[model samples]
Target: MTRFARTVAAVALTTALALTAGCGGSDSDADAGSDGKALKKVTYLTSFGNFGRDAYAWVAKDKGFFKDAGFDVTIRPGQGTGGVIPAIVGGQAQFGPIDLTGGLLNMGNGQAKDFVAVAAVQQHTMAAIATTEGNGISKPKDLEGKRLADTPGSVVRNLFPTYARLAGVDATKVKWVNGEAQTLMGTLAGGSVDGIGQFVVGKPTVEAVTKKKAVLLPYSAVIPDLYGNVLITSKKNAENDPESVRRFTAALLKGLEYSLGHTQEAAQILKRNVDTTNPAAAAAELELMAGYVTPKDGSGAVIGSLDSGRVAKSIRLLEDAGTLPKGMTPDQIIDFDLVPKG
Candidate 1:
């Protein structure tokens, strides 16, 4: 098995019995953690693996943010929407990050998350179809007859029909193949695919691997109202154990804010935890990601905050694209009372 699979399996095997991660108890009812504190024990999953983009979780654990929040968090690498959503809903993890738009699409497709979304991870959508210079794809129109690759349930691919309509590209003319998250950049580098579904901030990692300038057709350029990653937990957890949700969200946002501010140190921290990590590459990713994570709506909303109007617009866009069912509201996906307020 791949390291990610093996890691996830090992965690599932070990913690499945020990963890009461879902909405099984009250805030005061908890278990003893490693630090000898009666902190609630929960497993958390990052949307992707241990890339710099996901370092905030490790930061929360490393900097004692999780501990201070009165919890023992076991951080695990997730395999995108397909992998993470089921894990959170089925009780393997108590919290996780997911692309907000992708979650909506999943809900529309009849895959219920059992009521999720607690906070926003980024203020904007960073989904994009990225390619190298020599691939001859410079614009949306250029993507016609070109090949693309991404994991099966990636938002970049799931939301493509809407993006294509907005950008005036012929969505059906483009080709797609399945790829693992860890190998998408490699496929692009090897010229096996013209482009890969990637986040805008992934340019640094992509460029470093392909040794070429990365060209991007960012989904946000057309689908502006969509939020990026959003924090999610089971409905029972949010409704019954709200204090735990609130504390965990606060500590996680603290880590995300700190990681972005201290990019180099955050990268070093990731490297320290994951021996294969390259500090420079990780730092570069955080630097590019900073702008997206920053609130550009001029509403002065802090990090991890959500906006209602923007979310409604995203839903309308999805409905127009026929990927989403009608009457889907933001409240069904986001727990506004738990997110940061402006």
Candidate 2:
């Protein structure tokens, strides 16, 4: 099994042991319920294995937002967005914070029609094409005829066609080298591939592996309507447990706001939960991700607010790129009511 799978299994085992030992008391035992009852237990699955990327969730639990909301929340590391959908659908998790593109693609293709986005955490796409300093690849157009380390089923690979279209690059000519996620950066730094499509949040990791600064060409510059991480749950959960969903969204947004304002403290909180050995790097990653949770879009929307127009534009963009089927409206994929109001 992958390291992420092992970690998740370990956490599950520990939670089971704690529950068996009577240490895992319900929320009522801690006076966290609204009606003198135990708060509901909610499990959140992340999109990837990176602990640094999931700082908001860790901060929420650390700062007692979940407790205040009457929830005994547990956060687990995920293998990928692709695996996150099934976990939620199969009732393994109550919610998932995943790539919006993956959710949209799955819903649009009728793979998981019940899936809906509760709130958008990142306003813009963080995916970018990174090249080593002397690779001579500075722009999207430069990617033509060059080799890219592509991971199958990755959001970056899924959205590359749309990105290429918007950037006016000929996608047909680019050479894609299928590479494992763990080895992609090493392969790129070793001159095996000219560039790699990954999230800018991973810039520090890339630099550490390559021992050199990497140039980033953000996909958002080409596809401005693109979005990033989102809080997702099935329609059944939203409809059946509206109050619980509301509380969870509010608590998560509270954590996001705190993380945005206090990045260092948030990173420290995250470090305690995940295997992030480099405190400075974790802080840097959190700082870079903070601006994206709620961008300075003039819409006046708060942290967890979702703009209908932007959501529509994103759907249209995906449809145009053929990633999503035409006529698939945003309402079919996103439950706007689940987001907290201003």
Candidate 3:
């Protein structure tokens, strides 16, 4: 197995053991709901830290959406998108918010056959080429011949070729400088590298470090069909407890819609559960992310629903980028039936 695969396997094994130990008792031992009945215990794993990226899940828990759905949900922080699939497959988490590309690539590579996305949270690629204001890297083409801080396992770096193809640029000309996420923005600001392939969501991190606004060249600007975070589960979960999955999806979508309409309130709610050291920064990030939850294609405002056409396009893009095999189709990676309808 590759290093990434090995790391995921290790993390999944640890997570599964920890989770099993946490729920050693019977179902009746689970936390009681508002009705005094034992709520079904379920665990959720996120792709990253609680940096307002998972505001919806936080909001849902704080607002009692999961409780209303008869589930006592335990949210756990994940290592990354690469680890989330393994967490779910190994029965550590019943549901996970993961990167759609990573999930699809795993399916295409035959690493994960039972994993499928029930809901797409972000409608576009959150990855971008972030640079300082005066870096002279205004567009994708400008990245050619420039030194870019390439963080290990970054989705942006993995999909840089697809972005380059869409923007009509030669990705080979760009000089990649290996770095870590903690130091990428600092390195770029200190002139060690021209830019960094990062997520637009990290704008706050960059601004906090450099005390200057970061210029983001979003991958979605070039590849409009790309997707970001998604709600994924194993086929076994869907088959065994369809109602639980439905309730979870409905509650999550409700939380997403609530967050979109009440950004400040959502941030406050998120503060109660997650780390919001800078409330203003968290609120700002949530506001920017709200647009991602809104569908750009005039589809209904319901969150967590997949756009089949967009998924089809994304499949083709992944295939062309060599992430997915040529014969892989959307049906293998996505399960639209689990998304609750109005």
Off by over 4 Å in 3: 1-30, 147-151, 175-193, 296-298
Ranking by lDDT: 1, 2, 3
Query: Please, what is the whole-model Cα lDDT of each candidate in the order they appear?
Result: 0.77, 0.69, 0.68
Candidate No. with top lDDT: 1
Q: Give per-candidate clash totals.
A: 0, 1, 0
After superposition, which runs of candidate 1 have C-alpha atoms over 4 Å from their true positions? 1-36
Q: lDDT score, residue 11, model 3?
A: 11
Error of 2 at 296 (Å): 2.4
Cα TM-score per model: 0.88, 0.84, 0.82
Model 1 lDDT-worst window of ten: 1-10
lDDT of 3 by residue, 1-342 (tens): 000000011111222322211221222244776677778878887555454556667677777777778887777766456677888988988888877876776677776667778887887768788887887888888889898876444566767777788798998998877765334655776888888866676677567666777788888888877788789888899888887788888887787777767667766765555432345555666667766766655566466767777888888887877667788777777877886443
Q: What is the alpha-carbon lDDT of model 1 when measured against the actual structure?
A: 0.77
> In model 3, what is the error at residue 254, expressed in angstroms?
1.7
| Candidate 1 per-residue C-alpha lDDT over 159-241 given as tens digits, one digit per residue, 9 for 90 to 100 | 88888888999999999999876677778888899999888877777877778897888888888778888999998899999
